[model samples]
Target: MGDEAGTANQGAPNAGVSKSVSVRELVNRLKLEVIVGEEALDRPIRRSKVHRPGLEFAGYYDFFPIEHVQVLGKKEITYLHKLTHQERDERIGNVVKYHPPCFVVTWNQDGLEYLTAHCRKEGIPLLRTPQTTTEFMMLADGYLMKQLAPEIQVHGVCVTVAGTGILLRGRSGIGKSETALALIRRGHRLVADDAVVLKKVNPQVLLGTHNGTTREFLALRSVGLMNVVRVYGRGAFQDETRIVLDIELVPWKENELYNDLQLEPQTSEYMGVRVPCIQIPLQPGRDVAALIEAAAHNWYLQTQGYSAADEFMRRLQQQ
Candidate 1:
């Protein structure tokens, strides 16, 4: 039996997959200058939270998050300047002894002999950034969070119809790609064609993107694989979008009961995140693309506290 959400309880595939971003990746992506410890660029940054190490600099190390990337900003640098050389060396040593993934000095602050010495000795990567403390922290944290987020690859087509992100899921040769093509011709944007990578950005958000290699191509059963961007122009393709709905296309079965009225909500789970789902029965001469477009518009209305079903019921009662 299914749960109240109308989805069968199933284990999430690749839900517990461990993910990390290497210091080298961070440096290249963020354009950070490598000051020292180039040999340690392969160090893995598993945690998303970038540590400021303010307390550690003040000679307190209790409950320190040693696994995170340590960031030294303008405030921390100014604080170190007031301390004696010996005090600064001791405090910096105490923190670097843990051998955190890396150390980032923000705002291009100078006079880091003590910090660099310890980082070199411990073989911890020391990086420099021109952005301010808060700015760099936000960038690094966001990048790390996305890189380390739990992700699962789904065999489906993802598109944006009327600004709503929709994931079309069905078996092979079930017209998933064809419907997506139709939607694209109707001015909708295709995010991913064959394989959609869904990442759990947070508890309430699931972001979907295309598989890197196949992002620019779409496969149609009628025709062969075509480059969507080259054929349809760049406006019809999007790199990623927040998945708000899932549409499952199933073959029309004789004597099978289907929901005619979408009064109750249905959802499908991926990586512990539930997304609204609609199961559409496939039949001859059915305009599945039109149905999906309407569904996207209806979802937008529901978000604005307007339900067509409820309004219809009210009209019937008045009559």
Candidate 2:
């Protein structure tokens, strides 16, 4: 499950910064044939949205999103076909001079000699796909959203426990992987081990996925690297999940105070999203796996507006 050649290097500048993808990567991922401008495949695509160049090709360039991947569908191409050669040349020529990131022709429309020629001369990559305009745009936009989404890689073990995504963080050899392995044995799903890539999908959502090379695999200190999917079937591993809780495993401090009564809420921020956080002290003979499972269940209950601590307080007040 190694990551594709270029995806490993696709990281944001800062923790919450936006990221860009290359035209070459999109070409490879989208299976688009490069009709022209092969040399310009290295151009950066900063925008995730694709634009249909109908307005721009009609000589209205104001507020044009030149950074977007220009898409030419049937209507746009047919409109171009309606124009005389000289008229088409002037309008599309103006477009080429702007040097938009790239152009994509969908539905395998022909009569793109001028478009291809202009793109090649201006060093703008022009690609063609057999998919319809709508399909191609949707696929490209979806991929771009994932690629350009704000992401941060953390050193932790992510697993799906009782339908809630929990990220376990702690010092080296603090039993993160071992705990995850135990949870997997209990019918939970392992998301990522060692390195988990967390992406902010929405303002309140943080999605976690495995590093490409480690997808569907976990490294146990006792057994080295093992494929969870191969050993436990597909149900044992998941590619990604929306992280909802953070569990920190720490060595037990003899004199340290612990939160026995969960009256107050604790949270930790990742990729600009705040997630419920709990600390479980690691000590000999402690069942950390069961504790984490309990934490997940507790968090799920909190989400549903039911907290045992709150209920207990209400009963005491009534008394």
TM-score of each: 0.92, 0.80
Q: Provide the clash count, candidate 2.
A: 0
lDDT of 2 at 87: 98
How high is the CA lDDT of each candidate model? 0.87, 0.85
Query: Candidate 1, which segments miss by more than 4 Å at Cα?
Result: 1-12, 15-17, 254-259
- The whole-model C-alpha lDDT of candidate 1 against the native structure comes to 0.87
> Could you give me the TM-score of model 1 versus the true structure?
0.92
User: Where does the lowest 10-residue lDDT sum fall in candidate 2?
Assistant: 1-10
Q: Compose the digit string of candidate 2's lDDT tens values, residues 1-319.
A: 0122113223342555547899999999999999998889999999889998788888888988988999999998999999999999998998888887899999988889989888888999999999999899999998997788778887889999998998888778999999999999999999999988988767998888987999988888768899998999999998889998888787899998875785366678765577777678898999888998898888888789998998999999999
Prediction RMSDs, each to the true structure: 2.4, 6.0
